[model samples]
Target: MSGNDIDVYLEPLVDELKQLWDGVETYDANKGTTFKMRAALIWTISDFPRLKNLSGWNTYSGLACPTSKRRCIGEDADQDDSYWKKRSVFFELPYWKDHMLRHNLDVMHIEQNICDNVVFTILNDSVKSKDNLKASKDLQSMGIRPELWPDEGGKYPSAIFTMSNPQKNVFLKTLQNVVFPDGYSSNITRCVDIRKRKLYGLKSHDCHILMEQLLPILVKNALPSPVSTVIANLSSFFRELCGKAVNPMQLGGLSNHVMQILSRVNDQPVDVTNNIGKTMFPEIGKASRAVSHFGLTLMERDQAHRHVLVNCEAVVPFIDTFRTETKRKLWHQTRSPSKIDRVVHAEFSRWFKRKVPMDSTLHSKEMKLLACGPMQARCFRAYNINGYKFRTITKEDGLKTQNSGVYVSSNTSYASMRDNRVAVGSVPYYGNIVDIIELNYSCHFTVVLFKCIWVDTTTSRGIKQYHLDLTSVNFTRPTHTGDREEDEPYILASKAHLVYYVRGEVDQEWSVAVHVKPRDLYDMGGENEKVEAAAFSPQPGLNMSAAGDISDLQLTREDDIEDPIEDVSDNIDDVA
Candidate 1:
């Protein structure tokens, strides 16, 4: 029902509450005695606009603050009619008028409205942005923000509050590159469009997450320093307000920040003199190379060392022996398939490492090294090995997917060539690094391994290459992880090459892998180390440059302005 119709439905509940407040005869079963019971309804809750129905207070206009004493505009200029549609039915309860709070507006809708206004305005949405031709005209009529006022030709100039085309692309791209932890939040990337400069389909919780978490990050170097600072402060305020546990002592400080943010958001022309010493322009597109802040415990560290050791090339022979022995021991047990595999993964490494050391016959260097096992291992979310940058899934948060893709090739000798010589065929495995670990073998050497999550890579099931030289992999197809049975999940970090997985243009389940080669590095029949090191480097599109000032940002095209905007679409297109 509509807000006005809600009163009719609440009338019966109000009457029942009044009768209960007057004191009704009741039986006290616990005490085995009769008593009079009394109660009263203190307040009602609803969304903002419904306040008019609950408290008979019109809260639909700019002067809608419930605590204030402002009158809504009437048909005539002189008439002052406070927005009181009718006396609420609850007011019939005589005590209702004396209560301090008659109705409570749900904060959910409040936060949604606040976030929507800020995001839409910053994005300069055609239908939703508040800074349109009418708003500019309003500013002109109010004789304020002269720079934002429409010119003589009725053309709106670029306002400092709204983003230009280049700035918008950067802001959206930052969000597009963000990879949140699993189940932390929904995939917000689907809402962003760098090419169209639009973001839509955000729900209430989505807006809350964006406001409390992402707005501050996106505005960092994309907007002017003053503007970005004010937005960040406002976002912080919302975050604190909506926290699970809020300290009463901090409410005063939070209130103060709200006012400060409001004053700071009022746009003023660039005051070069005031910002002389401070950095006026932001370093656009420059990401920090900060190390990962997470760490593994001692037990986890030890387990990682064992995993590396089993995948080590020097331990291959010993691993095969352990597997054979395990299969022989379990052959007559009638164990389940899963149980047998579990036993192998759990006990094979430990038994082999300990047993091989006690065997005096194993005196070779590789055998001795395998018997002792790898030393305490170091874990990293990102590492540079074989001259190629590798990042774990967690470390890929703000970077292009290039550095995380890992490819390894294995050769099989089975067929004969045209000259009756043995033929070698190469098979490539593709996956993304989930972990990077460095294992130390005494003081003499160290080995880095990339623990990856692989796609099946089989011809008919997982991978396909188009005539256009584009390769796509079906991630839905699973491959055996080394944690289970035979296939090991790890590869020597030195053997991994780099590629980028771009979302497929046609199907969502597939991703196209794009390979990159090192810049200015070529093979001259060199050593394997140099050759592998020359395989990967940063892509050219990642290079970034800084601009001088906020004013240097270009304006939108004339056609884009509903009422004559600056004709700079060509320049905006160039920057994009």
Candidate 2:
């Protein structure tokens, strides 16, 4: 609507709102009673064009901003009375003139404008380029950047900010090939037209991801160092701004930092980077594979039950007591440490029920339930809980997107070979879930466990952070393969976080680990935390033997090496 058209449409709504504010009788549906009700219109939200129609402001002129008007750009900005279009219909309301806030600009569209301009100007689009001939003429009129002034032929000279044809191709192709985790954003690759050297049909969220995350990575060597650095800094600023939760105290500092980044880009001369590279991979789609299921055998059920018992908190006291009592008896004397551990796990459930009294003061309801032991577990292909969706490797095998990747931070004792002393610290382990099982405790409650294939996290063999935000792991060297009795593969499903590994550009052997945040949950902390990206290291040429089935592996002890028992409770936080 133009001119007073919006006012004509709003007249009836405004009159009704005024009547409601003065106290209109509202009916109580449940009580069948009528009482005086009052309501007030706080604010209206819209984009710049619609905002002008609603607020009777001239958004097309120099004094366009509704909040600051002539003072928006500077105190000396244009403030001519000719800029006035009309008085808003909202001002007709009694409280409208006195209202502190009456309109809010939508940020989604604002992001589009900023992102589109940056991309178009860099790509040097003739149609959408912000640094067109007119812009250069304006610069010439202002007597700044005389080198960028239009020539005698009225043709604008090429600016340093614009990308060369080769550079543009590399940037566009790299962006087109880059892959993101599932549900992170739409297919950004589809938005790029490499042949045309332009981006098209990008949604608001696509621009958001590109501005905050993908742009910095793709711009690395495509642009000059000064330009790329400015882009990186700007992206970082937006990343913090768009974080789940932001600290109000940091806003002043962020504002200053953004201004500095903006000024640096204009002042610094371009130093174009060379050796731009792009990595390409084929896209994957869902594949139909044969799925098989079978009931757990008697021995398999017992082992699964034992795995649950080890991680169960209420059963910890019983395990300690059983271990102590078994040490006193001569039964474990002839058995190896591995065999004894296996025997203890196998027999503990039967012994606990017979030896421990159900109604005893020490045995709480939880303890009693645990002592009775869990029945046979039910396997799942996929399970969702604790704000995460987890799938087994078997289930995710043929899928393009992975939901089976898992990572857990836990505390374990690290024995130093130099001093022969043990030091306990928290270590992050990366892996993929091989199986998911839900064990029932006689209908009282159930516990879900994730059997994972963990990468070797030892000092020489595990995760290595090569640079800031670059972490890599070798999937070939798995740690907990159930090869020895000490290898524990089961962990409480609640403790695992989601992460997906992407193959590195240079090192094909190592994959970059991208951490995925749980959706629909607010951090509620003082600041939004950042997880560094993990890249894989180059693998050594070593032929390792294949691992046998976990359940069929024999339980054996290593005579000299003593495996450290992890202090699980300390490392993990209890998530509700």
Q: Which of the numbered candidates is closest to the native, going by highest TM-score?
A: 2
Residue 280 miss distance in model 2 (angstroms): 53
lDDT of each candidate versus the true structure: 0.67, 0.69
TM-score of each: 0.39, 0.41
RMSD of 1: 34.5
> Where's the lowest-lDDT run of ten residues in candidate 2?
271-280
Q: Report the poorest 10 consecutive residues by lDDT, candidate 1.
A: 413-422
Candidate 2, lDDT over the whole model:
0.69
Residue-level lDDT of model 1, residues 1-576, one tens digit each, is 666777788889888888888888899999999888989987888777777777666676534555433333223356345556666788778588677677887877777788888888988898999889999999999687677889788889877868988889888999889898888889889998777899989888778888899998998878998688888888889899999999998876676467446645653111111212322111111112553333544454445556566555444445555666567678898454454545655676677656556343323434455457665556676666445667778776876555888887766311111112222468677898887766556644556667788877644477887756567887786564544434456677767888778886678889988877743467568456443444332443443345468886667664654665677989899999
**Cα deviation in Å at residue 493, candidate 1?**
74
Model 1 off-target regions past 4 Å? 1-40, 47-53, 56-64, 68-86, 93-95, 151-155, 267-576
lDDT value for model 1: 0.67
